[model samples]
Target: MVSTGITPSGIFHIGHIREILTGDMLTRAALDAGMEVEMIFIIDTADPLRKVYDFLAPEFENYIGHPIGAIPAPDGAGKPSEGGNYGEHFLSPFVEA
Candidate 1:
């Protein structure tokens, strides 16, 4: 098994992609080498909202240390998601990618 983890605390940067891609490439290479491989990805939706992001309103400061999945979306993307959680909001795009 090949495992990679991401904590959606802020922007989805190139470093995040690099880790995922590395794991994926390793998994694929193992498969090609006649080995069975399972790709595992860990999304840390429960990570805390540590600080108020530049894009977020100052009110978000009140949510510091709260689980990201329990907080509202900073951008008010929509219902459920708007109030869904921080990590998942950012995580969706990474999953699609």
Candidate 2:
């Protein structure tokens, strides 16, 4: 089995893509060589909000110690009940791409 994950902290930067791509190439090569391989992509939605990111609003300061997934969507794309799944906000776009 092969596993690779990103925290979805904010942007899906090139460095993040590099890691995933590396994992994907390895998995594909293994499969092509007749080796059974399982690839797992991780999204750490529950990671805690640390310092405020430059792109974030001042309101996010209140959520420093909370789990990002438990906070409201910064862009108003979250549900009232779920507030927002922080990782989901960034992960969704990456997956779709």
Model 1 Cα shift for residue 49 (angstroms)? 1.5
Q: In model 1, what lDDT does residue 92 have?
A: 79
lDDT of 1: 0.80
On residues 1-97, what C-alpha lDDT tens digit does candidate 2 reach at each position?
8899877878789989888998999999999999999999877777898867877777678878788778766674322234456667767788898
**Each model's number of backbone clashes?**
0, 0
Model 1: CA > 4 A from native: 76-82, 95-97
Residue pair clashes in candidate 1: none
Give me the displacement of residue 50 in model 1, in angstroms.
Answer: 2.2
lDDT of 1 at 47: 77
Report the number of the highest-lDDT candidate.
Answer: 1
Alpha-carbon TM-score of each model against the true structure: 0.75, 0.75
* Model 1 lDDT per residue over 36-93, tens place: 9999988877878887777777778788899887887766532233455677778878
Over 4 Å off, model 2: 76-83
Whole-model lDDT per candidate: 0.80, 0.77
Cα-lDDT of candidate 2? 0.77
True-vs-predicted CA distance for residue 32, candidate 1, Å? 2.5
